[model samples]
Target: MNATIILVGTELLSGMTIDTNSIYMAEELNKYGIEIKYKFTVGDNIKDIVEVIEFGKDKSDLVILSGGLG
Candidate 1:
């Protein structure tokens, strides 16, 4: 299956914090034969996060979001 990954964090956009979750998840998913069609780094905005997820949903079979929980 194909998937899209959305990494949400203001720190990510500002480069203050490095994102390792997406990379790790990507590797694990790859081992299962899941192809990642898109990877997006969005700031900690609810609207932006939802927008990306909606876009990914339309373009891929699965949309996975990580971070921005604080």
Candidate 2:
């Protein structure tokens, strides 16, 4: 199945922190033969996050969201 990982954090976009989660997730998911089609980082903006989540859901069979859930 195809998957998309959405990393939510302004620090990620601002280059303040590296997004190791996506890298690790991609590598791990690859072992299961699940392809990660898209990866995105969005600031703590709800609208943008929702939009991206929706888009990812539409394009991928599975969507994994990390960080910024709080």
State each model's CA lDDT, in order: 0.91, 0.92
Global lDDT for candidate 2? 0.92
Q: In candidate 1, which residue pairs get closer than 3 Å at backbone N, Cα or C atoms, i.e. clash?
A: none
> How much does candidate 1 score in TM-score?
0.92
Question: Could you give candidate 2's per-residue lDDT for residues 1-70 as a string of tens digits?
Answer: 9999999999888888887889899999999999999998999999999999999989999999999533
Off by over 4 Å in 2: 68-70
- Runs with alpha carbons beyond 4 Å of true place in candidate 1: none
Q: Which residue window of length 10 is worst by lDDT in model 1? A: 61-70
Each model's backbone clash number: 0, 0
In the order shown, the candidates' Cα RMSDs to the true structure are: 1.5, 2.0
